[model samples]
Target: MPFAGTSPHEDYTAAVERVAGQALGVLMDAGGAVVPAGFAVADLHAAQTRDPDADLPGLRVLGSDALAPHVLRGTPVPSDRAEAAARAFAVFPPDAVGASPDTAWIVTWRDWATARTLTRCGLALDVPAPGDGAQVADATSWQTWSVRMAQLSSLALPGLDGPIHAAAREGAEALSRGLVRSMLRRDYRTAARIARWIAWVAADGVAVPLDLAPLLRHVRVFGGGSTRTVLDTRIAQHVTGLEGS
Candidate 1:
């Protein structure tokens, strides 16, 4: 039984809660009965397996000391109906910070937030229609980006409110649209280039230092913001090579 409401906001919120709960349940079931032995339930998602390619951006995008769900979930709230619903769930206390085997779990949570924001703000995401495998890939990429965005949101920054998280949302949404095309078309060079720029932007915002070479090694091209090693590597590289450019 679910609460019935005529308000689009209410209905959207309920849907987000339902879907996020299901996703969480699936993750927990997959991770074994309890949260992974050594991990905090908040940090690591147990259900989905980690994709080496899923590290589109690293932890640098997150601020230090974590944002704590109590502080972030409800504040600087999204105006979009759907995005609000997802953000509401992403900041659930339990999922705030901990060991997550699959970064995709973090991403999925964040994607929920993005959807919620878009709805709340009454704005469109500026993404392409589902086509050429992009729809599925966009969905998957957002899911992972959402999780990482949540983690980044957890960190504390002065006077900025949730700008980092908002940026993450925008970035994730952007990546969702065309990331796979770069790879499927064998556009490794373009992939690397995009990764380098986005990665730098992500790291600069969060102030974390990362190296790109190791992250991009063997990574030809990829789509999806989270599960693409080359993308993550490029981002990390930008973090390290700030002055090199």
Candidate 2:
């Protein structure tokens, strides 16, 4: 059941889960092109949402996921859903997101992902050159660096390439280290997310340092609890050409 909009945190959490669950549902079906259950296709843009601030993130997430099938193959997102995604793009400009240093790279990454998705949808927006913050640019340790890459799993999509994606590729060993460490400690969520980044790197024709197939399978088995977790593994599968494996 969905939570009442009790607080900003809860509202945002609910939106995240809702979008992840509905998108997951759509991905599960062979012929499921219909809009996910929560909102009518016309009402999907955040202008009609109860808490636009809280819900905009959800819309952005769904919109990003909506582009996957298209990016993976030639399947286009349905038109009404594409319109909803375009509207969400207009509202959530990345610069206004007020992210701290730890999260600024993620926002930048997501903005890049949004731009890629929208352009494919023929609803392109004007995006400025992304600025790299100190947190990502000056990281000294693999520990902090790996965690940041894991957090960026949402942007680990096909054709979502940029400076950070390049950085992830260059730092492939650190990311693999993190994934191995997380899996060793049984932190499936963190492991799954890091694995997603590694998969993204591998998909870009870069050589992966770790044996990816079993790692992805292990994470999918143990980490497939939350909707977002499952979503991460699903995208990782597609990115690695292991979708049916």
TM-scores of all models?
A: 0.21, 0.76
Which predicted model would earn the best TM-score?
Answer: 2
CA shift of 125, model 2, Å = 2.1
Total clashing pairs in model 1: 44
Q: How accurate is candidate 1 locally (lDDT)?
A: 0.34
How much does candidate 2 score in TM-score?
A: 0.76
Clashing pairs in 2: none
Candidate 2 local distance difference test against the native: 0.67
Could you tell me which 10 consecutive residues in candidate 2 have the lowest summed lDDT? 34-43
Q: Rate the local accuracy (lDDT) of all candidates.
A: 0.34, 0.67
Q: Supply every candidate's count of residue pairs whose N, Cα or C atoms clash at under 3 angstroms.
A: 44, 0
